[model samples]
Target: MSPLASLTTILTFISVVCAATSWTTTPFNPAAIPLAVRSPYLSAWLAQGAGNALNDVWPTFWTGAIVGWAGFINVDGESYVFLGDPDVPNASFQKAVQKSFEFTSTQSVFVLSAGPVDLTATFLSPVEPSDLANQSFPFSYLALSAASNDGQPHAVQVYTDISAEWVSGDDSLTVNWTTTVGDTITHQVQLEDQTVFGEVNDRIQQGSAFHSTLNSTGTTFQTGQDVVVRAQFIQNGVLANTQDTDFRAVSDDWPVFALAHDLGTISAASDPVIFSIGHVRDPAVEYLIANDATQNRSLFFWSQISTLDDAITTFLQDFPNALARADAFDAQVNADASQISSNYAGLVALSIRQGFGAIEITLSKDASGQFNTSDIMAFLKEISSDGNVNTVDVIFPTWPLLLYTNPAIGKYLLIPLFAYQATGQYPNAWAVHDMGASYPKALGHNDGNDEPMPLEESGNMVIMTLSHFQRTGDNSIITTYFDLLDQWTQFLITDALIPENQISTDDFAGSLANQTNLAIKGIVGIKAMAEIASIVGDTARSSNYSSISASYVPQWQQFATSSDGKHLTLSYGNDSSWGLSYNMFADVLLNTSVFPASVYDMQTAWYETVVNEFGVPLDTRHTYTKSDWQSWTAALVTSTTVRDIFINSVFKYAADEENSQPLGDWYETLNGDVEGFKARPVVGGHLALLALQAVRTQTAMPAV
Candidate 1:
């Protein structure tokens, strides 16, 4: 048996039982646990490693910047820290012993022992792919429940706070905050001087951070310095319900918004205390349309709800239903993915939140300054890598998850790219690289000075467009973009067969001429255009593309295949070189038999021989590999053994103890170390296996 198989078997019998603390971590332990990741700015995580228990480490943004979120509980008048490390000087509070940690698609649950009482802290970020209102909301839920562990009743009070670090990434920035007492207690924190659409280290500098909980008899609110407020709760079990008048820099004294729930006496059952944490930014994105003008776009939730208070209250009230929906969604993903392998299921579960976290669904405003609900658009920030907006290559990798969850989301993501180019603002003959250089500002590159990935992006657009059409059966996208699509196809015909020394999607590996994988992508793209043409009743163009793609395949196989006939070359003439042909996944997904099955078999067999401890390398160039492309390549294999080899490798990397960052798509294959990227939406491609399975299970193909 393989190492992964042995590890899986060992994990079945592994459970740590001790007198002080009994621990049970199910499935596997991730490098970092996602705490409350909603949108790009609302993301938070807890790094997992030595001395990194829940109480020992602070929650961090995706960029690894500390976001002060702390939680403490008073058991029988004795304070214990359960959530974050506040590093209070000479504090008397003891740390809770974490008993278990488990994560699903939408929640990260941790059970900790605070004295004789056991606390379950659940961080839930709902993934409602079909519900635009809920999905667009930036808030995430934190539900805490306590029960007696030794059959003895104990008095408990739960305290949690959000520090001013959340308002801005820069520590020196001055922050001001307010506390409102209404149906719910809310503490709103923001920068004293807001810079709209500005970002510091990938954290928004203009948004207001709201920390709220429902107003109840036993609940009290407070806002003060982090050390002072937490020290108050540590000594006394309740806050003073006081607000600090002094507003200063985030790091000066470290201001915090706090709420405490006093459970008089806990026996067998205690009511759960729920809190909502989020960031609200008006005019979420600066979008460009066909008129060569830029307009501010508000988040889609704003159109559904008028005020921030309403959005928070509705979210807090809907916790039970939201939890149920998230549980169902998690079960469905696990059930579907386990059909292949448990490792694949774990990967799918981890990918869901990180995948959805990179996008924002926004509605454009009308002439009257009200959000136009009908004029909805979605934009994605290519996190960790240049922060490009609506990057074509980036979207290509991420579409599998969107397509699997809701096909309409895939259409929404494509609209911005299409709308920007249709205005004749882009000067390139092929597709544009991305909508903007920076996120939230999707100003089209009218100067046509965007990065040139002409062949890579053009093929990616055609393939993704056809895949979306196949799933949705909405030919309107094809009919509307036919002229541009035809133009891209023409560019493919001239440059695909002998690809110039231009970079592929793996631009980090540098440029190459006649890449075997690039050639296959272009060929499949041509075939995809044929399908698109046929859908629109353009038979002449369809036939032309079909014949061109068919003619190029034989030549591609001849030039790209190695002399040993074992694997494909990295470039056309370098027979000694080999690379992953992940582009073959499009052919499998679209069912476009452009390449023969023998090619799949050959590549599958060859991959097993070159596999490392983590997974197969991207190419002969480096030992590092992209998890997304690995999954895409895994979907191409015909054998279950080879497919599991790929799946298990990526799962091992995710569970690597040394890796403390959010799920990174690029990592070293030998030691399972992160190569460059982190918290990227491209991890959505990890669902390639399930996406292909969904495609195969369709009873009938949509008619054009």
Candidate 2:
């Protein structure tokens, strides 16, 4: 053969090997990593399943009908399933909790409960059963089955709020029921021929679908009034209800309480149920109940979970039984259906989608029995802790709107550590840009406001520094990043004094300098930076920041307040009304360490005057506003009602209510149209849920 022919044969062989290798490589395999120095492929493949499909990936379950999330693990005689935002560390922790149409997992013990009444647990899933023997379970691959609890053949029937129809593990039990929207379903699991709790004394009806019986072991009986339950784990080998393991929460809010270990004299009429939810995951946990009581018919929550934004709960709790919850379940579900029907309706019909929230990251348990990260979930390990992304700009500082209130804070919230990660120059610190593009590739700060925005960015840096310190309870970030903090503090101190030459991101209109609201920006920046000093044990620096900021607060008030003062001038001493957002950006969220609560309330009242249909305008002329900035300051109102209004306004802006498009960050209020800035990504700032959650949990909901 000629030399040319030989070369061609060699090239063809090489091509075949490459193809074969590609075909052999399974994306889900966690071990298949690139070279040591190479960047990670996608954010996550297991948690997300090649979640790098471009346009923000939606979780599998919400995508269509049956998207699976993290699988429930049957651990040492008990089973556990992560409710929302699978810790991404597990291979089974996908966006959707259900991967297969029908899920079946064979195990030993069985447990399931409804609000207060406890019963034999089995088959917790999205789809309801048509019959007791479960002719079919929704989705495929996944299953929850317990062969025999202890020695006897234990059996129980299951039902959901979706429909009264029942499915049973015991061949004889069956229920025929029907329901409509807004209706609730009551499920009972009891021993055969045993009467207990509220139900009338009846020999356990031979074919009774519901059952419950009281046993002496604290929570061994069926009862009402208790909205949550717990599991009892036997250490090593002690069996037969040794002790209560861990309890879950009906509500994952702060300061969750559980019953005492010792049972006092029990009045059969009083406390019937002993089990309680000992833990609760906040912020993210709200998604489990939403505002809907129906959706929560048989809901369960991961306990003791904290959020990046604890504010939303605090905000909502302000109106616990307020009208905010009226038709809440039905309305919300309808809204979701409307939104999905608009655009995302057909998405899952084609293929698997990711879960809700972030694609990477999961909180699971390791072999050590301690809750740790998952091996399969280690998809982005390269970029996770210490990857070489050149830079780490957290663009999606916020995430998953209603679900994730305090979301990411730019993946690495608090520190705003971008340029440091990018240039490998953690000099003073880094400039966090909401988040690094999407994830992992933190190089671009495509926020569009580059070369501009001093107040917004500067103040953010200081507060972020302080918050990070509080969270890690570590002073390293603040201590090392102090010099940079001073630079911003100094900049705010010297330059922002008059608000000249310093335009913040009150992007409703354009950028302006020395604006009245902006003065708060400077004050807050200085105060927050000083907070960093205090966190690092530098009382001197903290005092200095506080004292100086204190002096400026009233001065700014005197200077910015107008004569017939329902509102203040946007610019100091001038009638030129500009963005009122500076009120929120400065005095409210950030300067809390300095100004009195009244100041924020007053400022919020002033700020209220500027709100348009979309939100408070960036200025006097533009009918449009930036939802990012709107949510930013609007959320500072301290009043949950106001915050809810602002939050609702944001939903009004989002396609969730009607028009379905990628979250429109900028829009015109007059006609509710997308004015400009379509899918730029900085809108993640709107996710302040975690941040709000943090504030609420950390501080008392100030007496608004």
Candidate 3:
């Protein structure tokens, strides 16, 4: 080959590599996903739009939820109270996140009008529109009242309040309606002050903040061009201070471009927002569900967390005795806080954000008199925070509380583990398939990963089960499931080859053939199982496991390193070409007693090298990293810097960034924008008991 041609080919190859690596998930926006999150509340967001949508931020709950059409969107500025039991079959609140949007467009599809805008909001149920808490009866009002230069009132198009349904069951009554536009605006119209509750909404016209000439609670006005308007209900006097006192309550704004003047010229130059609103049910437990062309659905995490946090705060008001006060809080604060503060809250968050649920239970009971354990393992794995199997086809993974928080978690953990032994039912194996990538739903490639993950999963199960036994000191559960021990051992020996491609949770970087880390994990799993078998007096299997584990150490080292430096590569290459995070768990998670301490140093160095403003990126390629894994990886070492770096990583992702929803999993690194995923249980586990706290065993969850 010619020298110039060779150089040209090399240059082309280098360019291709750079190009592929340069692309962020959504390449255009810098504030795009992959940065860090500034909002911390998203960590607890788990509500799947039960009431109003959630917002993401410190002030707001999650970023704003996509309530409906852009025109009829509500801010995450409202507060939500748990009115009914979330654990109940169907639940609703008397007053929560008090807010709704009603919009109408004079143009094509939006409510914004270039010439004039008038809207009539009919309450589904009304009762003189007096007390704020008296939402039991809806009320009606007119807003966004505007007119043209011709000195004529714009057409008042009235719409129904579709949100005024029963708290749970189907019982929606049309609230009483009233009009206080012209003459009524000058008078109270036998109702409370409009300004007291809140302004209907702030009005603006074509980038112009429209100043209202009419101050009545329900009145109309004339405008020269298309305008924007906001409306809010009135209810603040202590006498009138009712149950529904959230600020998110307000009407929608109609944005339009301009109005045609007598010269036949368009003025103001604002783009009219084309949008629509409608009533619809949630999608079935299926994919590719259709959405109202005008309305989009976005789950809120930030807001959900805040509301939950508020509930917890309320429950903790009588701290040192939350469970003792359960009955009291139950009636006053009630199941709202209890339901949200417990494991269910975490689980709900996980399912929405990541797709699976995991727990670490302590073997103790709370004041509620409930004792959760291994028998409930399968349910624990798929349990949503709000309480139910997710309709979606996926699940997620977790970290410390390393699947070791409460005994309730144990019952859940064992469900899937024993299913494999009893019915050979691999479907609900309570253990994880990998480190959380579309699970429980078991959609897409996750299904293929199961039986294929024999060693990885079997080993994990053995370790977890043994850990549970050590913590609880109960050998009976093990005795009852000895047959599972046999199958698991065989699978580890025959199926656990370590190319790392078909390895455990560490598959995110890509496939590595014959990975040392996995091999070590396998050995540990075998040894741990052997210890269990010995405890049960199964001497034959114990010896076999010990022999295999003893021989595999050298092989682990052989394939993980090449003829280069002492440090390990991402794979078995002389290059030692690396990745964002290092393979530190090689000796750590496996409980390897005799590995080099240098491994920790080298891994920490690798972690440092991958650092970004948001966190250490997934690899050298980009800025974004997973908050959950950062916690897990940090748990392996004892360095405060290591621990803090990972902790701060999660902190950065949680506190700043896009969609300030209370908590969501995926976040951006460049500008701290929230990317995807919300309120996952795995994140709770990741955040709840990181580092040394992992190995410690507590039998039950902390009191509420």
lDDT of each: 0.87, 0.34, 0.33
User: Against the hidden true structure, what lDDT does model 1 obtain?
Assistant: 0.87
lDDT of 2 by residue, 426-544 (tens): 22222432323223332323333333455656666665556554543556556666677776787677755676654444343566666776676667777777777776778997898
Ranking of models by TM-score: 1, 3, 2
| Number of colliding residue pairs in each model | 0, 89, 121
TM-score of each: 0.96, 0.43, 0.48
Report the Cα lDDT for candidate 3.
Answer: 0.33
| Residue lDDT tens for model 3, 66-169 | 11110121112221121111111122212222122221100000122222321111111111101111111111111221223334433221111111111111
| Model 1 lDDT per residue over 108-182, tens place | 998999989999999999999788888999999999999989999999999999999987879999999999998
- Among the numbered candidates, top TM-score falls to 1
Measured by lDDT, the strongest candidate is 1
Model 2: residue 139 alpha-carbon error in angstroms:
18
Ranking, lDDT, top scorer first: 1, 2, 3
Give residue 138's error in model 2 in angstroms.
Answer: 25
* Backbone clashes (count) for model 3: 121
